[model samples]
Target: MFIRLPRKLFLFYVSVFYLIGIPVHAENNTAPTGSFKSKACMECHKKNNPLLIKDWRSSAHANTQPITDCVACHGKLHQAAASSSRRDSTCIRCHGGKKDPVVHSYTTSKHGVLMQLEKRSYDWNQPLADANYRAPGCSYCHMHKAGHNVSAGIRDDLMDKAAEKKVREQTRIACLDCHAPRYITRLFENGERMLEIGRKKVREARSLIEQSSVTFSDDELAPARAQLVKMQQHLTNVYLGVAHQSPDYQWWHGHPALDGDLLRIKGFIGELYRIKK
Candidate 1:
């Protein structure tokens, strides 16, 4: 017969081993990224708040980046306790809409919509891995594989064929845990086709912009360039839409929006030609 240790005892042994395995550095910003900072964090939190220390120790952030500690996210300056919204803001700092409207697109998705609608009723105390909420949030899918390793599920460079193929396989594996294999394959096929269509529309818009640039002065081509930006944004929306499984983004905000921008740029190109003539 196998006898299992209690969860607390298991954690205690793990923590003890962790303490022995890692070297502790003196508190200083000059040492390295997380070396000294993590040690400093562990020193205080390990005694006063061992549970938080345990969570961070087991996280990917700890192992991957040499323990991405408190200072990495919270900063060196201590302050009063923040609101509940702090965690969301911290996540958005890196994953937010700086380069793309990732958060915005998520808001338009079904998961996001449902999360917004039903988040209050959810047990906020439950760990993210439990998937206890009625609907998924940013953490649900992104952090599904590993809690602190949020980027585990996110594949960044979709343009590389090899990388894309890998992403497809990884996504299929993750989705299959909850969905049928056939359904996952169908969705992947559909999303790829939709993205291809969106890319073509963007290419057409770019071609029109290039044509306009030859004849029109910088001032005259401003509107076309502006429209191209809009087209690019729509293309991004399409990507976000497909990844998030949001039909509104894939259709209305993605494809049709790209179409509108393309046509407007074409109109500008025609206007420039007429002026040239």
Candidate 2:
């Protein structure tokens, strides 16, 4: 009787071979070759751990990609794999880098901060799409019925009025999963007000830059221009802080920082005026 090595185990050996400079000629140049059977995975896991199988069945992953499987995200060779497979990093297998803009913005938020602090105590076996975690992580909020659509409730470019409305509606629905309707509404209203204030600050800075630009050469106005760029970035941080419910980011890193940038630009413009006179 012959025993077949699991697909993940076989791939592990293949990698070792490559490291040792040994040649390999895989028939399909793929990990899931002819001998690998996803059914084999189900048969054993169903008997051993039916709850995990059930979670997978209910997930968008079940009906969708072939990549969303046992060995695909979780790999082989483990002490039953268990909750270890259900990490945020596992989502990154397909979702990509920690530095990804959406990922970065969220990580800097209160939700992400809480998740980072309390993740060790979380029930990793809980269904992420169902919002079963204590604090919402990437999968908890974004994993809709359609699968990992990270941009579902996100309004990165608020200038797109149509998109803003759509994303606002979606964001409301997502927030309602954990918060009161009144609270969500109030937060949205406050965020809009804050964003408007930030925008006004930016406009004031732009007018100053424009006034200086009219009299001075581009080279002369370069310092003010650079400060304007920094102010814009700080304005964006304010937007992120509002959206992400990060108070520290909203005040200290955002509005206050923007104010300082504006002051520097204003001082530069004043000096330019003195030089002109």
Candidate 3:
């Protein structure tokens, strides 16, 4: 009942269990999906081009779950001589739309507008020291120093709230390179205030919707649902479009659209209430 097996015998038994596909450990640790352990990229790039490897290794991309290797961004058919001008599209593939709402907002921002007008292109491998480059691109703010940490120093309301202060401080330091500290601070504070007001309005609309759902038929409730969706889209536009530096969107598109949607929601609620009475 208390026999102590020899260490060699114990090791041999563990080997047998493992070889037979029986798990000895209780923990179900598995690698993330879309991840690979192959060092094929590093094996070649490390010696031929050391700096590239170093840059990637230092980036958040290397550390994040579902870890990305060169193949993730560059595609499986990547060649050393392949043109890097297409990286922006590749970035948008994962970061655009609902995947990252800020990126969606950026597409409609002034910078995006100018880029489209001028037919400008951004290549991450290229240096930005040229004076001809008038506006900041995605790489300018997020990928400075060719750093892979896309969210570095960004103050995203969608991200972790606990880190907001630290992120804001870091973002201020980044902004100080081009803007006055006072201006940057005011801009960020205003953005926060705008986001707060938008959130409150959305909450009020949602409350009205919930109350309407209790009495209104599906056909009657359809317009309310449509208005609520519009309200959320405008609120998101306000929050993210400001952060993306689109003044016109914040004032002309986002704010006005949100106000109209809120009114529509209120009108729908009043109509439903009158019907109920």
Candidate 2 lDDT score at position 142: 57
Superposed by TM-score, candidate 1 places the C-alpha of residue 51 at a distance from the truth, in angstroms, of 19
After superposing candidate 1 on the true structure, give the runs of residues whose Cα lies further than 4 Å from its correct spot.
1-101, 121-133, 147-149, 152-163
Residue-level lDDT of model 2, residues 1-277, one tens digit each, is: 1345677778988788876643343333223423334577688668756766776775556666664766665566443253565667767667648765345666777798888999988887665544566677665655443233445565555433356556667667667777889999889888878877887888899988887777899999898889888887788777778776777668887899989998998998898889889
Residues 31-140, candidate 1: write the lDDT tens digits. Answer: 33333454675686677667666655655667665455666665654442222323344566666563346877777777777877887777655554544555766655
Which parts of model 2 have CA positions greater than 4 angstroms off? 1-86, 90-110, 158-162
lDDT (0-100) at residue 77 of candidate 2?
A: 45
Ranking by lDDT: 2, 1, 3
Q: What's the TM-score of every candidate structure?
A: 0.63, 0.62, 0.61
Locate the minimum summed-lDDT window of 10 residues in model 3.
24-33
- Badly placed stretches (over 4 Å) of model 3 are 1-39, 42-68, 72-90, 93-110, 113-133, 152-163, 213-222
**What local lDDT score does residue 61 receive in model 2, on the 0 to 100 scale?**
64
True-structure RMSD for candidate 3: 13.7
TM-score of 3: 0.61
Q: 1 or 3, which is superior by lDDT?
A: 1
